[model samples]
Target chain A: MQMSPGSRKTLLRQVPTVVWVLLGMILFFARFAPAFFTLKNAVNLLTQGSILMILCMGVIVVKITGGIELSVGAVMTLAGMVMAWALAYAKLPIPVALLLSLIVGGLCGLLNGFFVTKMDIPSFIATLGTQGIAAGISLGMNNGNVIWGLPASIGYLGNGTFLHLPVPMWLSVLAFLCSFTLLNFTPFGVYVYALGGNEQALVLTGKPAWWYKTLVYVYAGLMAGLAAIVITGRNMCAQPTVGLGMEFEAFSAVVLGGSFAAGRGTAIGTVIGVLFILILRNGLNVMGIPTYIQLAIIGPVLIGAIVLSVLVEGGAQK
Target chain B: MTLKSFLLRFSRLLALVLLSMVVAVLNPNFLKISNLINIVRQASPQIIISAGMTIVLLTGGIDLSIGSVVTLASIIAGYVLTQTKLHWSIAIVSALGSGLLCGLVSGILVAKVKLPSAIATYGMLWVGRGLAFAIMGAFPYFGFPNAFRYIGRGILLGIPVPIWIMVAVALVVYLFLKYTTLGKSIYAVGANPYAAKASGLRVDRILIYTYMLSGLLAALGGIILTARLNAVDQDIGAPFLLPAIASPVMGGTSMTGGRGGIGGTIIGTLIMTVLVNAMNLLRISSLWQQFAIGLVVVLAVWLDMWIKKKTA
Candidate 1:
């Protein structure tokens, strides 16, 4: 029974399936464990996954465009601060504040895209350079202060619920839907997959490749902006450091979703990945696992998944 | 030469100078000799780490294990210094040896096993951090000899000890990059793997040495940092990894591969280190400092585009 090639391949595939199984185990625990099954914990997991989902979507988009965006987390932090400032300090209306936040995000995203696409700079280096810039702007703008005191309406996104789901969770679902639609339903989406699959070939197609590449970044930026809204709402406050190390988490999620780091992505897979991480983290917290050990667990899971992806696709990759 | 290429290069050089000038003018204290020394000393570790990182980058690889290796090495060094009767010199070797071992593992995973560098290092990051945590508990190490502090704190007449070490490392890396066969092979490998393989270079061997060097430098940095504080913590190397890569990128390392230098990275590190310390000294709130770093990273990345557009 063990000698069959089909079973061997399935076994190899099942190696990576362990992470998905872990998700199932966590879901089971959430169902049976009194502490884990509480409404509060359920809502907690939802809100947590909300921000992670939003950030992960952007990462997926950037990855799909055949580039990495390491600065999404940094930009998210900056936008969060800006959104908070506009509502609290600038004393703007909610709509205006949202617009300003979106604009900031879009501009940052545009700059990053422009650098990588137009200037022929590598996306990783370019985004990293911008990560510092985003941090600096946040610091200079606020002098390292936290943003607070937003009107209750703007605060609704963080804690509000509809149909029993947390607001962030709803937003995450919306973002996921939008990404799926954009990637699958539109010609521009077609262009993106083609772009990632082969940049030079796409260029030879006589299209304005830069514009297509740039648009995904802007879209990613918009997603980050939305994430900031939910994140700020959840905390009812925003700080420059709010999103620190977030990009890596998002990147890890994207990778775990069975997406290639060299830039192939699927929205559905990424959503599963994001959910898997959210559940894993929340479940661990509920289990009284130490934070350090929790991080250690993530490491093994990431490696195992990646190794599984490589091994399963090794022959097919060529 | 093409006008676009020349102008692009010129603009990069000018951006480097102007950035320094802006910082200097904004704070006259930034221009002082003491501040200059401080900047170099601060950048020493990052500059060293970036040297090896640049090589890895050239080969289209990343090393997340840097943070972990540093943590492991510093702890090993710290434990030897505090708990054992072994001399400091031997302790240094033991510490650096551990870092090399981690780096070697990552390299083998990447080069031989053909695992992505990012994934391999990510695993090492955890394992290494876990080892550090297991050894040090939750508290910072404080029982080291003051003499060990000399590596971080001593000055040669007017210059800081760390600054001298930085200079020596920079010169050595530069020479290696410019003249050595292995170094040239690294560039060749990065520039075109197929071509290099056809030309009879062992790409894996080059990659292994490159990452090993990165690990060694990062470990050295952790030891210096721990010595400076007279304590080692698990958190030390973790935060520095991004900045390590960021400085080199800002200095114009082509993230794609085969385009950058130790000179540019050194300058970039100096600018960032000084800026960070100055912010701290000025007592800018932590939030603002984080915001500022984010903004600076974005702008530096954007600068390439702005310059290219201008040239176009």
Candidate 2:
């Protein structure tokens, strides 16, 4: 018997839910085998997942605008280093340093947006160029040294607990809520999805899509800046390599959440995706798998996610 | 060629000459034959890989996985030489074969599976790098035979053997693109894939062939790199990724596809090699090298766009 189109669409929509169930079962089994199912461990996983979730949110916004930003990780590093330099070297107030880092991150995003919109460069190439520049700047800032001894107030964002939960977890939740509101409630958010859906149609309506496109990148950069803050606070140090490989992780999470490369992704789905990755990594760590081997596993998982999304979405469209 | 095309093709060369003169003034050693040969030798791997990258870019695709493929290919060769009793020549062929397999996978994903080139190749990049790291446990592979080492370091006709290999590969690529039916098809496909398909061109086959060729050249580069260092490591090919891409882009190859050639890539490679060499001689910190590269990439693309706009 053939399935009806309506049924098929409903079934495709359930794919993420089914995957989440399977992931839960895996965690359940893993708890038994490796004794990794503790409440504390679960909370730890959420805490670690928070930074990635923030970064993934940014990526989702950019992806929704039909643009890719490969430089977010590098921007995160530079922002963190700048924050570290401000606090440690300049002896600035914590709030001032935080603002400085955010500004730097926003400016980097602005540069990326300018290249893509004004210079007519591809998003990937433009961001890759920025990636190198940001990374180089991070390296040059402290000559590749790690800055430690951050004040307790600064560490509060990453390490402090509120009502028995990590600050980063709360921050991530707040960020996700804000993003959901921005994406679903505002006209600018509507424009973002429209920009991805059919840019020319929006242009035909006499709207300036370029500014909206640029705004998405700026939002992404801001998220990265926030991530850098949490990362530095948690470690109590800022290093040139702190955010290395994070862009891939963010990309993987966003894509795994069923966001199409061409645009159309939800912030909630990204949260699920980030949790799945964190649980998988935590489980692997518990099982004593080497980091490199874990990396190997993530590669196939990312490809599988892409293949699944393509097939399911293609079926839905048909 | 018309004057416009000539200018477009030689602009990089002109930049190279101008930069060289400035560097020579700053450091007299820059003009020495030894330093010049060293620059060419150092740029051999870039020239080789960029030759392949030019084809990929020409087809409006990318192969970010080439860097990881280089590492994996070299590791495979290293494994064959150290773990097994295979002959050196066999090990070398197997390395190239591994790269070919990778390229085939990327091609199938892109051409048949209909995935975007960036996502598909980025996935391949992770897989390749992961395999390289997993296989060697993140350790460097050493202990190559002297004969294998000769391929990377030995001099031939007063020049490095790798440089000779690079030239030979570039010549073959030049001939292939200029004279072959398949070569012309690549340009057609990149120029407009839908139109090319409607016109009876085998677009998928062209894409697969181009990616395979890119993979093959990247593998060749890995082998030369392995031989030069007399060891294989995960990080060896990491630095080459940007340069591989930047060389072609700087050489006037359009990232959007169908507007550049190997001739431009060679000049682009020379320009990059000279820039880095000059930076070293000037005692600039190594940390700033990436900054320089990033700036060059952005400026080069901006200049290309400006020129296109003006001519139009």
Candidate 3:
């Protein structure tokens, strides 16, 4: 029997939930198939997923504006390097170093925003250019050397526990709460969705859509900076290669979470998406699969997720 | 040509000349013919790839998978040569065939599957790179026949054979773009897909062809790169991808589509090659080279936008 359009729409909407269920199955199997399933492993998964989740949050914001930020990974690297320089070489306090890194990231984002809005460049090309610049700066900062000997206090954010969970995991939760509220409760958030939905219409309505669009990029940059801080804390060192290929990870998470290509996403969906990927990787590691095999899986899975989402969303519309 | 068109055509040329003068001043050896030939030789792979990329950009699409395609193509050729008794010519054909296959897949994804070009191609990038790694098992392939090396590193009457191949490819593409009905249709499609469709142009067909051409060219570049390096590795074309994209954009090809040509791309390639050569001559750290390239890309786009504004 042919399904009605209404039924098809409802069925398609369950696709993401089905994906989550599949992930749950994997988690359950991972528990039984190997000795890798324990409270400690779960905490490790959460902690590792936290920084990536934060990065995915920023990516979601920009993607919601119908733009992509390819430079976030590089910006994260740059921010880490800058923070490391401030803390290790300049002898700055941890708080000041962290603040400076965030500012640097924000400025990088602002430049990306300016290029997209004022300069009328495509987001992909602009960010691609900036990615090179940020990577270069990261390498040039310490001549590609890893900066070690960060103050012990800096480790608190990355290694500390709060309420029996990692501090970074808690921070990710806070970040998600803030993002959800900002997206749902604020006028600016509405503008962001509208901006992605029909930018020309907003422009015709006499609204400065460019400002909001640019702000989205700025926010993404700031989040990258925060992610850098967390990563540096966790590793206790800052290296030029930190955050390599992270943009792809975040992009995959955002897409897998049902964020439309033309912009539309949710913090909760992204959390599930990030957790799904983290669990998959963690499981692969436990199973002793080579890293290249993991890459092979990720590439197809990302493409499949995007294709499925497009198909389902299109069906819903019809 | 009108003054406006003249400026559009020669802006990159002017930049190239200006850059050449600065490099010459920095080091007198830069003006020597041998050094100049060396620059063109180094730029051959980029030039070949950028020709196809220009066409893709002109159609308002992108092919981010070219880098991975190059690696894969090289690996395929390398595997055939090393593992099979196939002649080098057969290996070359297979390498080119692999690239064409990749391009065809990407074309179908973008045109038939109705996926965004960027998203589809980006996905292909990962798949292709993964396949390259899988095939080679993280090892580099060497020991190719000397005849195979001739395509990339042979000298023909005191000039590199790759430079000759690059010039020929550029000539063919220039002619195709200038004198063919399909070429004009590509421009029409890039200018306005809806209008092109309404006017009886096969928009999807043209898009597919463009991406296929991009893939083919990327494969050709892969072959050349493998020959030049005399080895095949997983990272064969990783560095060329950015420069391939950047060259066409720097050449004043509108990323939004329908406004560029092969001539501008040549100048862009020259400028980039010369710039890198100058950096090496100056003993500048390679870390800063990426920064310089990024700065140049942004500035070039910014300048292009300014010119468009002034003309408007």
Best-matching candidate per DockQ: 2
Interface RMSD measured for model 1 = 3.6
* Cα-based RMSD of candidate 1: 4.2
Task: Give the Å error, residue B255, model 3.
Answer: 1.3
Worst 10 residues of 2 chain B by lDDT: B6-15
lDDT accuracy of residue B89 in candidate 2: 96
Q: lDDT tens string, model 2, A206-245?
A: 9888888888888999998988899999899999988887
Fnat per candidate: 0.44, 0.57, 0.49
Q: Name the candidate, 1 or 3, with the larger lDDT value.
A: 3
* Candidate 3 stretches greater than 4 Å from native: A1-38, A315-318, B1-5
List model 1 lDDT by residue over A1-318, tens digit each.
134556666676544453555566677777766688788887787777788898887778888776878888878888988988988988988898888877888888898887777766677766776676787677668777787788888767888878977778888989999999988899988888877788788789899988999888888888888898888888888886788788888887886676664446688888777777777777778888777777666666556666656665561142
- Cα lDDT tens digits, model 1, B1-312, are 887788677555666567668767667777788777777777787787777677787777788788778888888888888878999887789888988888898888788867768777776776777777767666676767777888888888888888788789889988998999998887788788889999999988988898888888888887787777788877878877877777777777766677777877876676577667767656666555655665565566567557757777
**What lDDT would candidate 1 get against the real structure?**
0.77
Worst 10 residues of 1 chain A by lDDT: A309-318
Scored by Cα lDDT, where does model 2 land? 0.85
TM-score of 3: 0.94
For candidate 2, write residues B121-199 as lDDT tens digits: 8888888888888888867789899999999999988999998999999999989998999998888888999999999
Q: Which model is ahead, 1 or 2, in terms of DockQ?
A: 2
